[model samples]
Target: MSTDTEALARSATKFAVPESLWNDDVAADLSPPELLLYRSNLLGSDLTVTNFGGGNTSAKLEGVDPLTGETVDVLWVKGSGGDIGSMKIEGFATLYQSRLLELEKHYSGPDDDDKMVGYLPHCTYNLNTRAASIDTPLHSLLPFAHIDHVHPDAIIALAASSEGEAATQEIWNGKIGWLPWKRPGFTLGVMIRDYVKQNPDVQGVMLAGHGIICWADTAKDCYEHTIQLIADAASYLNEKLGDAPAFGGEIVAPNPERRAIAAALMPKLRALMTGDRPKLAHYSDDAETLEFVGSADFERLARLGTSCPDHFLRTKIAPLTLDPERLNDQAYLQSSLEDYRAGYAGYYQRCAGPNDPAMRDANPVVVLVPGVGRITFAANKATARIAGEFYGNAINVMRGAEAIGAYVALDEQEAFNIEYWALEEAKLQRMPKPKPLVGKIAVVTGGAGGIGAATAARLMREGACVMLLDRDEAALDAAAAGFQSEFGKDVIRTAICDVTDEAAVAAAFKSCAVEFGGCDIFVANAGIASSAPFEETTSAMWKKNFDVLAEGYFLTARSAFTLMKQQGEGSMVFIGSKNGVAAANGAAAYASAKAAANHLARCLALEGAAHGIRVNTVNPDAVIKGSRIWDGDWRKERASAHGIDTGKELEEHYRLRSMLKRDVLPADVAEAVYFFASDMSAKSTGNMLNVDAGNAQAFTR
Candidate 1:
């Protein structure tokens, strides 16, 4: 019969790899230079090739240094903090290949990582600047101009199985070498160099429970070969397992209220994780997640282990799963998570050495929600999204392995060593210290405009995840996008919520729970303004004004109260007005509503104090810019009332009239709101803080 190589030689295969994209003829087509970074980008862009920070690539080239005016043989390898898909020239740290190769003699064992980490930087072409990757020596020792390494889902499926070596040999035969699972460092690099030297005919090496490495003379050939290698494994799985198990029957449309259920559980989960102290941003909702979570063996399978051991840096050894049907059962979810944390502690105790770093918090980075998919928690928005992307890709890898064989991962002791390794832990030192409000979640009602939007942006700057709620869809989308662009994607979310409606207010808070584990600071800032003398003010006019300003604040505050009480502590802020304090004629309805809202805030503060909650109001006047409350007619009347023309004069008038001689910007109001939300004003509450540029008339008693 045909050999494995002969079968792969045939064009007919289920797994497909992209055609090589290298373009050598520059004059024929004008484009960015197709060099190492270009090729790296090609590999990095496809999640099929690697997950976040999962792969490394290198190119050896003869180059002239503009700085030194000398000919140099440089190995440009991917540096930390650079994603392959978006790799740039700077992303590729150029190291003297000859200098790197000499390190093979220096490495005594994996324990040498700490010393190697210090040593590798010294040998870099630019010693004062860029540091080379730990795998630099392995890349330099290989006898190839271009090298590609990846943790592709399909490839990992085969790499992380009991029959990985046998299955791989069946497919590639003598064309590939196999390496046992050796922890990544100097020793593993030496083993790879020796193996490749012995079997020069092999195109690649499959490292069991690790990943795959492919090397060649050209970038295109190396990249294509790596893709082809992964594809071969995928094709093998397809032939044996007939692809992943399909979901049974039409998945009846998911419970439309799963999000609501998740909301109720967020505080419960947070209390279980942090004891009702800090808030964390959470993201749950991806279609493919349910298939994995709902599988017959999920409860047992998820606990078995991770398909990729290195993922322990983020996801720990395994994920904690909960019954999807119990999404709303707060008591059950909380108890389950408590058990998960206890189990993790026990595992740490079993594997931890005397020198290991202190155990990390028992809280999980990824929570598997059966019907809902996954809920990823991070200190901030960007990290949560990146982690979600990584774990989301993991589902596919494990599914692929399961389709072929029982998935295998590193043992507890091994994973613990990698996770707590001083070298690995040192890699995280480069990240800056977190801001004061890091891990706190803030929800702002009417956040699509004015003071609300300003507060959202400010909270993000201080390292809090924000959820913006508004009645206007367009404004909500635009505002949410702006904050997301500035802060980072998935950090800020938007929900259309009309605060005057009790049900809408309830659902809006629930969305906040799903977006983030729960709320730390809830801002009731929805408001509107109108002007009319009491003689002309109809009952309808008073009702409309009260419905939004007074009633809306009550509804929003009431909703936040319930959730905060569940979590045991939270902050509530009301955006009031100077109009409420200094009563103005011809705007009696607006003034009365504002006055009533301020009173409502004080009452909540009184009640909130008993529950460990703090309530405050930021009362600002003429913070008119970006305010939805100020319509054209209202602005015109305000200017006419003050005998000023144009919007600029109106601003200047308010500025000069204030004791501080400056108009109150929306940001000024936000600052006061932030003070109450943060511990800065930890002891002060049940009162209003004036942000009207020092308006003595509006000062509280």
Candidate 2:
């Protein structure tokens, strides 16, 4: 007999969900879709049951499209960033049955969870007109029309228990198929699809410690199955002497004008990073969430995530705690923001990896009011709805678990591992297809200021998760603050790394993963200049210059290639100098090191392509507006040595060179790096692009 049967035989001796229990109405007065949404939202909020961005849910309504007149069927699935509890009609997207089935046939070799959703029909509809949930495919995979996937405390309490799988098998028997937790997304869909196809008679799938999937031909059937299954699990728990402790927590007062609070906070947050305003969602104008946020255990609870993994993707790892004590203090608010950001920095330090995405700015996604209510944050309305639902459910679970024995969620390191795993990090690499650049992690060494800063900024604007690795702590802080001041903190991140050290470089890359989620575009822009004749260019001068330019680039490229290879895709760009191509007098070490850097990039390009990684170099000529190479005494001396006035030399150089006649600028060079870092040059690997404004040809002059 199947393990499920043997377990079922054992469970047969325990209390089961009586057939009559199905007749009792589920509380909360939710419609079929709305009920599923509410339950999912609740589950999404439960840190004891779900992880941030981990789980998904769906409901299917068969209907013929009037536009087609033919039997055109569609399955409305939950799109990514959507949590079921507060999910609205706009949070769902309709995929034609034919398309979902067609997508099933062409199994791309195991892809990331979020990108796997991209393979679904193009989002032709807006969230307002048509929202799409990421779990739509998992729902579509079920034989039944209505399906729900949730991570519940009582349920996972059973799943993660030592006898969990066996217990579930016994209770569920032939009715449920247990699936080991694979990372959710396309691979997950493939796993479920294969299982369902193999076990055609199963009514549900239980994932160990992950959650449970239930389905039925109708919404009611699906709901009944879920409720009964959960009840059965709860019964089993009670039998084992597990009693859900009484809910205990004092409620805080609500903020009367909560909506105004959310609105005023948006611009302040947007000022911290580059992106659209995050959407906001809330429940109970009275603010139960606020009370929950102010609970004595709030700190530990706030940092903790949902019970299962999938919840993290929806609610993030944790919600922002709005302290009641600092309610009216602006300084306190500022300090709160600072504290949150610093905490994120610490989290990055603890959890980041070599290829992880960088941390976006730290902004509150969900605000737990002391007495008022909970508030959800998002870049758009759709995401807010998702946040609100997932967060609300998560808070509810925490509150419930607190009544028993404090919600014991995953540790920071565990959360970090999942958040920065290669597959999940791959989502950071996703860009619009048929585009300029893709699958490249460019690290602009010295990226905290000047051209390095500009290069990092330009790369992100061009769709790369730019990792700014610089030794200048002051520049790093200023750049991070400046970027957060403008972009809202989620897009860009800075690392204080001395690139010459291999260990430091490796650690910095790991931090990049924790900060942004992954690294694909690398710039290697860190370097220093010296203007001395061959005799004056001492051993110290040679070593220092080579350390930054040659050794630094080598370490960075090696790290980038390792991550890219594991991910099966990536790109790297080296910042080479015009002096490297044609020597400049009195700058022997700088020139030679740059030449070595260029060759290093070319060799990487040749080898990286085999692993689906592209490598390239950008040769820039005297484009130094804020560079150490061009400022103060260095500029005048170089100009005098080259036999022309500084201003006149730059002008003559630009004019005497080629047709464009424009002076090379950091932005211009950055644009070249951006092109190679993105899909614009997908097939152009092992290449070198010049951003020298014709000055490359002038080297011969």
> Where in model 1 is the C-alpha error above 4 Å?
1-34, 65-68, 243-257, 275-281, 285-287, 324-331, 643-646
Candidate 2 error regions (>4 Å): 1-441, 646-659, 696-701
The per-model lDDT (C-alpha) reads 0.76, 0.62
Per residue, candidate 1 scores C-alpha lDDT tens digits across 281-389 of 4665654465556555566667876757546566767887877667667778778878888998998899888887787777777888665567776666567667777
Q: Report the lDDT of model 1 for residue 287.
A: 49
Q: What is the lDDT, from 0 to 100, of the residue 340 in candidate 2?
A: 71
Task: Assess candidate 1 and give its lDDT.
Answer: 0.76
TM-score for candidate 1: 0.91
As a whole number from 0 to 100, the lDDT of residue 665 in candidate 1 is 82
How high is each candidate's TM-score?
A: 0.91, 0.45
